[model samples]
Target: MKDKILIAGGYGNVGQVICSYLAEKFPGKIIAAGRNYEKADNFSKTTGGAVLPMKLDVAENHENSSLLDEVLLVVMCLDQKDTRFIEACIRRGIHYIDITASYKLLSDIEAMAGLAEQNGSTAVLSVGIAPGITNILVKHCKQRLGILEEAYINLLLGLGDEHGKAAIEWTVDNINTTFDVVENGNLQKVRSFEDGKESFFSEKLGKRMAYRFDFTDQHVLPRTLNIKTVSTRLCFDSVIFTRFFAILKKLGVLNLLKLKNFRRLFVKVFENFRLGSDIFAVAVDAIGEKEGKRAEYHCSIIGHKEGIITGKVAGLVAEKIYNGAYASGVFHIEQLFEPEEILKELEENIEIRCS
Candidate 1:
């Protein structure tokens, strides 16, 4: 059976990578969907084969009765705000893969597991680098150690890389959120970047400092992995932004960044300007008693472009859905696939550098 992959944010940066990937690999079976029909149509034409143009707004009339009637798999590249979209897919017995960064959103989706099983659909969340690969690494350490005590997941983004406007918007909108943690084992109100704490990353994006930043995995991974403590941090490829943000955080002025006007100011100043290298990194530091021996697994994945990495993970998950390599229920990427299996695929060139 030809796997029909439907990408929701098909015209956006990461979605294009995912759509192009599935189109090339699966052939004559892919849908580029978004709210913008012109862009979606343009992307479909650009691909010229296997890529179909479809317009569907998840926020409005999310019922996929006619919009997503026969798609075998749906790779969501958009920020998933609600479970309606996931529920629509579940109602149709379609597999759902999301690359979103929302913990509340996943909690909402998890509430629908019974409905999902009744419909024979699986909603897989956290299918991107930070939450995606980070979860896999956690699984690996948990398996090796048999019992995990704590973990620190650090994420780094390339400020110089041309990220999608949507992604940039998401980042800035949530920038001043009541999140960010400064200490371990406790969730306190430490403004994002207020902590000058540093985490020197491994090769491919050498030595950099990371500050406490909120990503969904840090909130969900501990309970999901049965670990006592887990914290995630963030940094950029350029020291300039990191240092500046650190200061702004101290002054409590990062909240200004949440304004549209300031974001416009930022776009005008930094959009076309590549101040640093196009590199991304993820580091996992795990510690616990492994086989009754205390051990730690410190690993990282570095890449120049997230689009490439996101597309590959999306594709691999698509392949799994196509091959029925999934259990019948709602699950996160870590829950759906073992860390060893996921790491094997990543090592085999699914867009991740395992070390």
Candidate 2:
């Protein structure tokens, strides 16, 4: 029997695409799980994958049933208020992949490194675009530059993609400001849309501006990789929308914008707004010494929707762990796989430029 792959939020926006991709490739080896069995089953039927439904709830108190015992790999698409889900996976010695951006929860999950190692279990957290691709680029730069001065990361998201409620909710939940990009050990306040703009001469999307925003990887990478200075910025395709949102953020109205009615209006306008394309771009700059001399590597990629790129990368990471292609234990995306192999897998859609 093919190994069973469980996707926690198997019917979500990014989850659907991943399910389709996995179903097409693996066939009859998927378990599309979520709280909503109807949606999960419906999605499974449409994707033509034999999806088994499971409650697998991550509430305050829940038990690890035998249902999860058969699963070899678990893809976490749903976000939990805590780390119960990850704890369950670790205890069961099941390989896990996640797209969560919560640093708090990731930190809690990271504490399980000892348990994961003891169980010979592989777990990959922060496997989305910002954390996934960004982490990969950081590792690549660090390897290239023997003693790097600083690493600057800029992410330009395509706002036009029809993002699902979960992703949108995630965005809204993160709309407030808290994290600061560390440059040379200096903590800089990262107010939303406040980071200065950097233009991206990317394919498909053309030139776009990137702003500094707090993401989970920005916190985890600096400590894990031992890079001195690290900072992350975010930008979208819609200039007008960015400006408007930034102003609202400055006025302290962003919290009010999270209401259901406000979200509806925002989505409605977002739907009508010709503000973005389903294209994205990433730029990584590192300054350091190579061959006993100073050198820098500038790497970039232009691809599809931010979510699609994120989901594809997550899927690839999941496959590696499930197939034993990567080492067991708690690891980041970069530690588990080769940067070149990952870039090769995404070559069909992404255009890479390195200097």
Best by TM-score: 1
In candidate 1, which residue pairs clash? none
RMSD of each: 2.7, 2.6
How many clashes does each candidate structure show, in the order listed?
0, 1
Give all candidates' CA lDDT scores.
Answer: 0.76, 0.75
Residue 325 miss distance in model 1 (angstroms): 4.5
lDDT of 2 at 212: 65
- The global Cα lDDT (0 to 1) of model 2 is 0.75
lDDT of 1 by residue, 183-285 (tens): 3456666545545456657754566778776688877776677777777878887778888877777787777776779878876666667788777888777
